[model samples]
Target chain A: MYVNATLVAQLVVFFILAWFTMKFVWPPIVKALDERATKIAEGLAAAERGKQSLELASKRSAETVREGKEKVVELLVQAEKQSQQIIEEAKAQARIEADKVIAGAKAEIEQEAARAREALRERVADLAIAGAEKILRREVDAKAHADLLAQIKQDL
Target chain B: MATTGHEAAAHVPSAGDYIVHHLGHLNTTGHPQASVVDFSVINLDTLFFSVAMGVIGLLLMWVVARRVTSGVPGRAQAAVEILLEMVAGQARSIIHSEESRKFVAPLALTVFVWVFLMNSMDFLPVDLLPMLWQGATGNEHAYLRVVPTADLNGTLGMSIGVLLLCFWYNIKIKGMGGWVHELFTAPFGNHPALYLPNFLMQMIEFLAKTVSHGMRLFGNMYAGELLFMLIALMGMGFSSMSGVGGSLMWAGHVVAGTFWALFHILIVVLQAFIFMMLTLVYIGQAHEGH
Candidate 1:
């Protein structure tokens, strides 16, 4: 078998390159890739966390809006109830004052009516006395005339 | 230019002479290999050129490495770094064991660089060195083929080395008894009746793997060498021609040579990368007992 020098030389050179490059170049390269992969994983985790938080925030914001709306509605209902109560109170106060005024007017009217009735009775008695004197002759029994006046007054 | 060379090589020397001379290395002291493998008969030409190119590639990597920064890198570092990253990544994927990968990863890188440096030899002017040597030595018998990848012997030798590694790993990772037992009982039961068939199948598998692994490298190198020869023949034809055909020959040599060289760049890198990946894969397979 013919020996080949070229073949052996090539083998030597190849082994040398393999040794040198593997020692210096390949390790760092492999480490670089590992680093890049780790970074990507971390970035993905962060992004996932960010998305989760964003979702939670959005949900909370929606809940807050709903709560705010509910609060507003409750306040409006309370305002409406308060206004209704105030109106009812105003109406009750007006009714009480009106009842007091009507009672005072009725009492005053009754007292005035009693006084006018007394004055009208007195005038009627005077007219009856005058008419009796005119109808009778000059000297008649005063006691008998008084008795007739009383009867007339009683009959009127 | 190539056409001129084509006519010359087209003469088609007798097959015996052709094979012998083409296979012969232009040695330093008339002996190419050592006594067992002629050390003195060293193909100094190939060694000089191969080492020089290997250094250039290493220097290139080193320069790029020196330039590397944590910030946005330059194109050179980026490209080299990308290649380094790709090779390491592939090595990790193929050879899972960290201890094994320590060696295997470097093995793959060296495979790529050495093979690539060897492959780049095809780009040198085919006659430039040989003609120069003939002029300097006054002897035309100093025929040289520069590219190591173009040498089938070199490729086969490499494959053989890988085969040896595989074998060593297999035996080491799996004890001899385990290996033998697997040979006799695997894919078939441990039953006495199936032993023969199992052993035969197992033997065939080992033989097939070893043979194919070597042959694959041999075949690719052989084809690349043949193509270079053909291209060289074209250049010879152009030189011979003086008139129209001769001029067209020069033009044909140039155009075909340029296109082939450009396209060959892809083949060279691809072939190296493929061989490296396969080496990793085979080594990984060896790590497994079955």
Candidate 2:
């Protein structure tokens, strides 16, 4: 129990242990702790960045969908207008074709009527000449009948 | 008192003999003589056990440090990490200077663990190691004290180390001249009239702190060792008795031993922590200007 050589030996051991611990043990453990802290901070920052980008991407995708719907609606309206224009153009074309066909038929009928009348007038003039020959015999009235024939043709 | 082997055991010792036997140290010069001041004598048991415990503490720390991982920690790793954090936290609060803490924190940790290991040696049945020593060397009266902290020399040795650190920091933080000046001048008054009184008070304070610091641990642990010896004697007393009284005394011995051992767990750990904290606080105080 007295103050002796053991006390001095112990003090030396204490100093050596303290020095060894400070030199070797402490720095690495503290370094590990600090590294873990920095790693956790960086991980949290990365997670925050990912969350923000996810929100941005979701918003962008939503806007893209809305724009696509608007374009589809505009395309549908344009298609409807084009179909209406095509229907009106088809109706006008049919009316023009009908008018042309009716005009062609009227011209053909007028030509046919004129031919029939000329034939009938020629036959009537022949019959009149035969009756006059019976009434006034032979050559005396031939020269006067020429003017009557011409006047009869005009009346027909 | 120096007798060994079967001859020493042939005579049943008185209470004084038993206590004296337990108190004696295994010295470099074979048997330690009873002396109030024996500067040349080295207590071999104190040196052996202290170094052994110190090595064990260092090995435990080294293993934990080597296996430390950033990944999920195993139980051992986790336990060590918690201990490290606790020491770091105490050092951080007490010692503000980061540079000082690099040495002081680990020093505090070593002190705690080494003292704790030494205190825990009391948990071993008081007679176990000495009996083993007796059997091994065939010295029936072999003297060995396992609990290093129970030795006044050992505790005071550690406290002296702390005193040295305090002195170092005092000199480092305040220049040597400044520390000397403050030691004489600041605590009472700057006047020359108060210098002697202040210096005397300062010396007394240092002496008191160091003495109490070492004595407190030595007193507690020494008392515990004594209690264990007394309790063991109670069992020995009953072994000579017969019948129910003998059985009862045997049972009491076991019960009392178990109870004290359980309770001493708290004392051992608490004493170690208190010693470590006081060391840090003293050193921290040294770093501050008066």
Candidate 3:
């Protein structure tokens, strides 16, 4: 088994096979591997992004709930303050109405008292004139007692 | 003993004749009596079997290529992918040039598959192919060797191809001048007097590497082939006696042949891998500066 033309033939076949493999076979297989790697990496990245977004959304929802609770607390306090102010206004109004009614009743009583006193004073003047006429016997000089009557009236 | 067609018609051959007959090749030139190192004689059997194995290797790669997918792979696809990854790993570690690997990696892959196929032919019964060849040609002396790697010419041919690749890369990577200068000054001082010695040493190293690379594979496979023949001869010896002893010999042949074949599977794959690795190493070294 010595070397001869077969070696040349083998060399030719080796080169052909090597060249064919390099040109046709290797590229596609390597490309498939690389593509699969990139796809897996991209999937992982997307999953990471989705997880982050979910966390953010949960945090945002929690903040909204807290803000809603705070707003409800503030509204309840404001409503309570408004109700107190209304109660205070109603109490002050009732007090002022009572005071006005009392003042009207006092003015009416004073007018009525003044009227009664004037009537009593007229009646006393009349009765005193009649008694003086009776005591003086006759109508003697009733016209002449005008100045006395006036003074009596003044005294009454 | 397992005899060729003509010997089968005649009396049994001596052990030497049997071994010599098994070692003969179907040559394209030169007589069977010619010297072992006859350059004009081409071993037709080695050429035929190697080329056939090479085609089979190419077909296997081609089928995998055509059917390969990016998704989850089937068993065949997975097997090919694993093989490819293994070759790529070796090439990456040895050959530093990413560009050269485009060629070198596939070259190594082809070499491994082809040599492994050739080496695997040793598993077949040693007389099977030759007997068939003798029968087909109607000639008792038809010389047919089944395992191509068992032949020195086949292994040396491949190693010489690797050597040429090494030389090509040497020139391509380090210019011709750089390679020549390195040959004269490598692994020693750069004195004018040492140039001849350095160059001679470098040549010897190349020669030694190529020769050993080829001889290692040839020796292993040749020994294996011879062992199979001897085992077959033992079975033949027992069969000629025609008794319980003959039956025992048949059993022994089967047992021994099976054990050896089982062990040889490792050699088949290992030799292929070693040859591929050396190819990568030599080619890689060519790309490196002294």
Candidate 4:
């Protein structure tokens, strides 16, 4: 209850304590708080950047996939056209080979018919000469009938 | 003073004498101070407890400061940060100058923690420390008042320290000439006849702020301490009473003691806050014009 020299002593102690706190306690804690706030802000910004990059990558992949699908469709169409052209060329080549074979067969048939007719005419002429020799007496007119036999052969 | 049971009962101090004895402080003179105001005597108990509380409180803060992290804070670190934020917030709102806040904020924090610790001393059982002191010193009539804030000198000592800071800030912010001029011209006018009245009013304002600042904390803590003493006196009455009344006195003692102690918890923290706020306000006023 009394005010004595203790008041003065306490006043001195008070200043000392306040000074000690100012020197040792206050700054570090406040600095930590500020630093923590900065760190949280930076972390949030980084997270946002990561999210944006992820979105961009997804979009790019989707575009590439679409491009790949179109390329596949184009290749399929080109292959189908090439296959149709190859089938048409093969049909034309087959038709030409068939016509050549038919013409060669017709030529062979004509040659064979001519050879057979010649053999028949020669045989007929020989038979007529034998008959004439039997009908007339032996050696008469052989030279005179030569021209007629030749003409008959030519006609056949 | 060592005596058998019968002699001990006879030697026991009366209720009034017991309270008066507890009120006595351990001072330089080795006796209760007789004078109402004496500059020569020092209350060693008040100084010792106040310094002890100050040292302990600051050491805790220092330890937390040493290990503080910008990352997730430990519980102790978080608690200290909360207290610092509250003090710093008040300081920021009241004191406009960033440069001045460097010192003033810490000063407010120191005042809050130190006063709160000193006020918490009231929670100790009234006779606990004194009895221990008597046992250690082997003095049957040893004096020890634990709550430093209960002593007018201790509270006034701190309030006066705040006053000195106010003076420093006034001079620092408003230069010596400007402060002196304001001291005379403020809350009145620039007129020459108003100077004397303005000066008088300024002095009274200073005096009133300082006294009320110190007296508020002192009065609350002192009254709380006295009420504890009175509650303890009821226990003495219980011992001296017979069957029914004795039991009733005992119940009253326990009930009153518990209720008062619980209520005093609020007062203890509130008084600390008021002291800190007033400190910021007064220093802030010093930064402003009249």
Top candidate when judged by DockQ against the true structure: 4
- Greater-TM-score candidate between 1 and 2: 2
User: Per-model C-alpha lDDT, please?
Assistant: 0.70, 0.85, 0.84, 0.91
What interface RMSD does each of the candidate structures achieve?
A: 3.7, 1.3, 2.0, 0.7
Candidate 3 on B1-290: residue-level lDDT in tens?
A: 37544544567776677888888888885246365455666778888899899888778777878877787777876787788889999999999999889899989888888889999999888888888998899987788888989988788888888899999999999999989999999869698999999999999999999999899999999999999988887777664656888888888888998899999999999999999999999999999998
Could you tell me how far off, in angstroms, the CA of residue B121 lies in candidate 2 after the best superposition? Answer: 1.2
**Candidate 2 B-chain TM-score:** 0.95
Prediction 4: B-chain TM-score:
0.97
**lDDT by residue (tens digit), candidate 1, B71-169:** 556788778777776877898787778888788877877677777777777677655666677668887556665666555446655776777778777
Cα error, candidate 4, residue B283 (Å): 1.4
In Å, residue B234's CA in model 2 sits off its true spot by 2.2
Q: Model 3 chain A, poorest ten-residue lDDT window?
A: A1-10
Q: What is candidate 4's CA lDDT for residue B231?
A: 90
Looking at candidate 1 chain B, the ten consecutive residues that score lowest on lDDT are B1-10
Pairs that clash in candidate 3: B6-B140
Candidate 4: misplaced stretches above 4 Å? A96-156, B1-8
Q: Model 4 scores what on Cα lDDT? A: 0.91
Candidate 4's residue-wise lDDT over A85-135, tens digit each? 899899998888888898888888888877887888788777666666777
True contacts kept of each: 0.43, 0.69, 0.57, 0.91
Screening candidate 2 with a backbone cut-off below 3 angstroms (N, C-alpha, C), the clashing residue pairs are: none
lDDT of 3 by residue, A108-137 (tens): 999999889878887898898888778876
The better-scoring model by DockQ among 3 and 4 is: 4
